[model samples]
Target: MRQAEKRAIERVASKRRNKNSSSSNDEFEAEHICIRTCGRELKCGKHRCQQMCHRGPCPSCLEAIFEEISCNCGRTVLQPPQPCGTRAPECRFDCTRPRPCGHPQVAHNCHPDDLACPKCPFLVEKGCICGKKTLKNQPCWFEEPRCGLVCGKKLKCGTHSCNKLCHRPGACEDEGISGSHCQQLCGKTRSCGHLDTERCHAPYPCKEDKPCQAKTFVTCECQHRKQEVKCSATKIEPSPQRPLLKCDDECLRLQRNARLASALNIDPQTHTNDHVPYSDTTLKLYRENPQWAHIYEREFRVFAEDRAEKRLRFKPMKAHQRAFIHSLAEDFGLDSESSDPEPHRHVCLFKTPRFVSSPMKTLAQCAKICASQDSSTQQATIANDATAIPYNALLLTNPQFGLTVEELDAALRKEYAAHPTVKFHTSFLPSDEVVLKGSGTWTSQTLEASLTALKSTLQHTVRRLKLAENVFLCSVDDSLNVLRREGGQAQREGGWSAVVGRSTGRIRMPRDR
Candidate 1:
């Protein structure tokens, strides 16, 4: 009976146990729905889980999972464990709760006591305390206000707004709808029904707001005053009339007169009378007074008489003298050939006064008489001579005044040696004179040429020696016959001086006669 009673109790216990097991199974299945949907391993009651996993784990499961994983700070909260061999496993945990110092919860598994927690403040998820979304992850420990997201909207001035982000929590006094400080200084409605948003310090008045156009007086070019409308106060235009001085009739007349005077002054015709018109004045005088013509005629007759007298006085020997002078002038090429019948009254005037004193021979007479005398003397000398000598002689003045007779002889020898075709003899005469006698088989022309050559050589030698001033060379025959007088006293006289003294009426009377 006791055994039967125990069996009944056991069946009842077994039935109760199955009911509890089925109930627990339904609860476990309901909790595991998250894991099944996420297709992940169960994390519930795991020692590493700190936060409840939204996919699979619950708050209770996270509390139980991290129950034995104590942080170094003695906090029970810990991070979920990673696989053993995974790189950089986050095996540590942190208390993500808010702190009294306005920072995030301290981190676990840190070093020194001071470093037990992350000293920096936490960033608000939405934004910073200033409500700027751009402040995400920024340190909360910054004392000054922080500005982060840029405000890119347009300002009232029609220019771009300040690009600075919103200010920190306590920085701004007024905040706009964009969560930034209000910085708009323009964008106001005007009475003209226009949005005049320009931040202009000095506003311009419209045309309608300007004062009335002013009235002023302007002078015309004729000096007549006229009324003119001026520009508006806000506008600037050229003067209604140019600022010019109007001229009167008298002024214009003066200017015209001045221009006309200038033009007349510049005219060539006006200046044509600058020089004295003597010829024109004389012609006009003669034309005006015909009776005065006799005066000019009488004066011209006196001039002609005077000219004739002067001619006769200057040339006393007209018949033979004039003819002789003309012949000489012709020979010397001093006279021009012309058909004019008038005598050359100016010809044959004695250059020296002494020639006028005696019965002088004109150059033509002297040339003819001397030439005849030369021929006659040459014939007489050749005929009267006993020896049939073919020789010529030249008389020359010594070129070197200071040279000795020996030096002179040596020069003459040198000169003679240059001409091998001739034999020469040199002899000294009275005064500075030398005579050279040459014997050669030569004609008159060849003799002349040799004489010329000898004279030239002597001249050059004298010059090289820097000799005396005068060196005269003449044919011996011509000098003795034509130039010298017959007496021994006359031989001492030079040819030119004797001619001059004898012609000047200095003839000595014959004392015996």
Candidate 2:
């Protein structure tokens, strides 16, 4: 077939899929009308909900079909909920395609299709390569990476059209990311290697020829009060998910345009294009409009947090236990001379319990180093005189500014293995290094600061959960709280005093008590 003929044939092939072929699908579309005004029809963002017109106004249409359009000028308010089709005075035209105007939105003078503003100079179509109108859906990607062309429907990324994300048209830093170099040609490329591997493993594989032939299979559309983790600060109920309505018609195309319109809220800095700010209200409306399964925005956030943290934790689990010391040292920025984390002698016993002990020598040296270099890191109110080893001492060797259980294990090994004349009994090891030189090592000022840092960290983690203000962090051990919330804060409850013993900056073995 000729190129133009093939294009026509393909476009028709795409359009044919839009028609209502089955009663089940039609019923599904009828029951739930996804508000195009919400990010998009199909690809609703399952994240935080905020300022979308759908969440703000389109509540009625969630379960309702196209009824009427309503309008109200600033001077006169339209009281009654008019039909979805009922047009009014203030707005000149509805989306040319007859999409529901979710609310009395900030009315723009120009037509939805017109990329240009009424008389605004900002609507210069200087980068109109496709020669398409400069409306919202018809975004001028040529103009800038994050364009503001608002559409009345969803926007889709066909393997061909989505040259940027799906198949990255040109070569980036990524190898074999070129169209000619997909899995078939350059399986070594990162995208090809990882994404293709994922695709191959999928029960429904993407054919080598038609990589993007796979349709949108599963989507999470959430509604109801679902809790979510947000910004390491709060547990918020994120917006619901909007499942896409599969179609091949212009309506679907228009919905896709709408999806693109409400779809992205880009952070120019990180180059992360998140779904528009989602909220519980926005999500509920989104789910009602185009109902589908969702991880829910809040749930998605929580899911992501869990995923990231698990990823963070998984590294240590994956590595050899012998490398534990190096991993912790590298993770917490520990070095040999710094804490003399170098080498020491050891006395061992069976099964290093969940909590292990280290000599005061090591702890004292760590305190001195932290005090000398990054004195600001010296937290307040540490129980230096406590019979147990300080928790921060184990953390002094953390690669990532804070300490984790992995680091403790790593540090214990680091101290013991490096000791030239190490003596180990069975599983337990104790170091003989006189880490701190002077009687002045355990100071009121030093201990106080360390304790304060621990308190501060634990408090922060609890606060992020968005519980009551009175809620203070109480954990299996405040140390676990401290360990988990390092660089964060936790809350404490009424009349509940923290044992504040040896978990966080200090370690207490079975014998230490």
Candidate 3:
């Protein structure tokens, strides 16, 4: 047959098969040669059919609807494969858009990007940076809520304050933040009469970092000795008392001469100019006496030189001798006091109380020196005297009224003048009371009698003086009372006492008799 008749016959048969088609296969028969894709829109409005042209409805839109559905802030987003027209899941996020007032946006459901964010609803209470005032329930939009108060905080200079409004930016002295500090120069004059080379400050002294650089003339107390020193050595005006600056050997010699002249009842200048204040006869008299002021002066020199000797006691001397010794001690910068009564009166000198940096080493050296000096026969006599006392000392304490060393000495002498051999000394306690320790060759009966006499005398003295009630220092009436009250034993067999050594200027161990 011809080509035309063959084409016409195939078309007629294809139409007849389509018209009589019963299976789904016949529907796809047209799709085999169909090159056009299914362009029909699917349930997802964003994507269309992606399969080749088909005879029936397109398969469920498989062209994954990859779309980004986000909240208004873009913080929350629906990931890929999301269906078209699928509204974003309920957005539970706060708006992240920049607010005009710089405050955090309020919490709200996500909406279109074009929609404005919700207004901030937070109200805050804030204090001024200086902490002097507070703003109540300030709106969130009003950031850094500042009060009307000024920032009166002191600057680092400590002399000025930050005068800017509270809540101002940056540090108090930052130039960029319009803050300022004390810019005034220190116009105050230094001890050298030169202006201070520093800014204004609170402390009157020159700053440690910037010590006074000028030099000034410093003179001794008598103005006889002058030396140039840094202005810092001289205290700022209004406090010119600098005794240490006046410390000179010449000044000390002059002071000593003045004191000597006063003691000798001579002119100060005359005494100072004299080569020898005392004549050879007077010197011989002091040497022979052994308890004279000259002998005590020599002993005081030894005590002053010894760092270990904190205190020194001399043999009994006359009142004038003790007074001379006290004046001499003043020259040596030692504290002197006369203790004990009448014929037993003596001078005691004490070194200034100071912190010993190396007490153990000093004490060790002192012990060594004392040991080496033990070869003297006089030292042996003093040792024997201390041993003789042993524990035969009686302690008389006065609690209500304190007595000076001199007062105690006088009182003891007047009270026990009959027992002249009974040597008594006062303790070095700071209390306003006396602790008189008496030592001698005492028997049990003698000790009891002495104790009774002391009690009666003390009670009578206290009553006469009108002291406080119950002025008894220690309950020494009975041995049991003494032991129980003061934790001490008063037995004549073996009693303990804080016995002092003899007049050899050597400390000895305390002993119990």
Top-TM-score candidate index: 3
TM-scores, one per candidate: 0.18, 0.13, 0.19
Query: For model 3, which pairs clash?
Result: 402-432, 402-433
State the lDDT of candidate 1 residue by residue for 141-200, as single tens digits.
554445556655444334435555665443332335343234443333233222233333
Question: Given candidate 1, what's the lDDT at residue 211?
Answer: 29
Off by over 4 Å in 3: 1-63, 66-109, 112-116, 121-124, 168-170, 174-198, 201-513
Query: Which has the greatest lDDT?
Result: 3
Q: Tens-digit lDDT track for model 2 on 1-513? A: 368756765666656555545434555432222322354332122222222334343332322223333443233234545433333435554322322322233335324233433222222234322223433433222343333332222112112122233222232222445343223222111212212222222223443332321111221121111122211111131222334433334434544554564467432234223212222333333334232212222222332334222111111111222133322222222221111011211111111011111111222233344335444433332322222333222112112222233433443443334332322111111211011111124553454344344444423432443211211111112222222222333322211133342134565333330
Pairs of colliding residues, candidate 1: 46-65, 47-65
Model 1 per-residue lDDT at 32: 27
Compose the digit string of candidate 3's lDDT tens values, residues 414-502.
66675665665554322223345555787645654565556567557645654423223232222312321233333232122322222
